[model samples]
Target: MQRGFFVSGVASTMAENRLDNITHNLANVNSTGYKASRSSFKTVLADSHLAGNQKQTSSASYLSMGSQYIDTSAGSIRQTGNALDFAIVADGYFQVQQANGNIALTRAGNFSRDGEGNLITQSGFPVLDDGGSPITLPDGEVSGTNDGMIYVNNQPVVQLGLVTLINKNDIQQAAGTLITTPESNTESAVGTVVVEHGALESSNVNAVLAMTEMVATLRAYESTMKVVEQYNQLASQLNSDVGKIQG
Candidate 1:
């Protein structure tokens, strides 16, 4: 697998993976609370250990995709003027209960009240309160304070469920805009989060940058494929010449 063709094969696959990620970022450029993914690279040796292998074979080195992480940077907050919409100005996530009774974190706060007066997300998941219970609001001019306290007509209702992650890497994005982390990675962030009423957080993906990277990745992939193709042709020609000489 240390041959030039084999290395080019791996390179092509890696480029395709990068292109996929870039495509996803571009697609979600307008999505609410969307975080873009970033890819990393690492060098390895075909002798099996670049980190600890004492072998001095520089020609056998290989490149690989190291890791992928969700960029947790905050996006622009836009005022929607809708009372149900909310935005977290700082480091925190909103908690919502899933259909299977599991909890997930999200930054998308484009919420609305159900017919039963329960505050739910756009996906219909009931939003949790500071006490880890569903937030049931009474009708008539709903509002929230900067500290996530909800009040209706100047009467207190409940506080939004705000939590923070201990390790940024612990957050894993799920289907749609929802994300989850292990229970050990999360803690109640009651006063740590600053919420804005009548606003929503846009995606952090930069469209122009992503598009440029997409083109670059595509070109790199094509170049690797050409190398692989050229290698195959030369290999075939060499085999044919060797057989003719033997005959």
Candidate 2:
């Protein structure tokens, strides 16, 4: 394959990956406490030959991994009138107990109580209290405060676990979600996260921008495909012409 064709092929692939991420963010725009994700791109370095004496120069550009971006920007808080719904007031995450016994951090505040009276996200993951215990809300009208206290049956039953990231950049995003080794990084996890009841966070993704980028990426991909087809046709014609001359 021609070097130009190879470069265009890689660029198209990278653009498609970025488009996928943007599409996902737009799809989850209405999700409660959802955060928008961006894509990070890095240029691949050209191969280096043995240096003569002083220095070397780059030849061609390549595509590196397309990193999933985490938008730490705070979303707009909206009141939902449901006491179980909550929103973070600052830089922190509400820890939830995943099915695999691993803790996961999320901004999604739309929560509910199970038949066992356990406070959990809509996905059924149990929300954690300040002590890392499952919060159990009683059956009644509930009220919570930004200080991390939830009142049920006129008594404080659970305190939401609000924690902040010490090294926000150290967190890695994989499979369209953020994951970290919570035990390995102690110093990076410091201040407690804050929670406000009766409210939920909105996604920061701009739908208009996402849609525009998606359309542009699609067109670019099509153009690259056309180039590849032209190359193939030219190569085929050259072979046919050579055979005719020899015959």
**Winner by TM-score:** 1
Off by over 4 Å in 1: 48-58
Tens-digit lDDT track for model 2 on 69-151?
A: 57777888988889789888877777778788777777788888889889988888888887777887778878876777889
lDDT of residue 4 for candidate 2: 60
Estimate the Cα RMSD of every predicted model relative to the unseen true structure: 3.2, 3.8
lDDT, each prediction? 0.88, 0.74
The number of clashing residue pairs in each candidate reads: 0, 3
Candidate 1 to native Cα RMSD, angstroms: 3.2
Q: Clash pairs of candidate 1?
A: none
lDDT of 1 by residue, 58-113 (tens): 55678988988889999999999888889999788999998888899989999999
Q: Model 1 Cα displacement at 55 (Å)?
A: 7.7
Instruction: Give the candidate number with the greatest lDDT.
Output: 1
How well does each candidate superpose onto the true structure, as a TM-score?
A: 0.92, 0.83
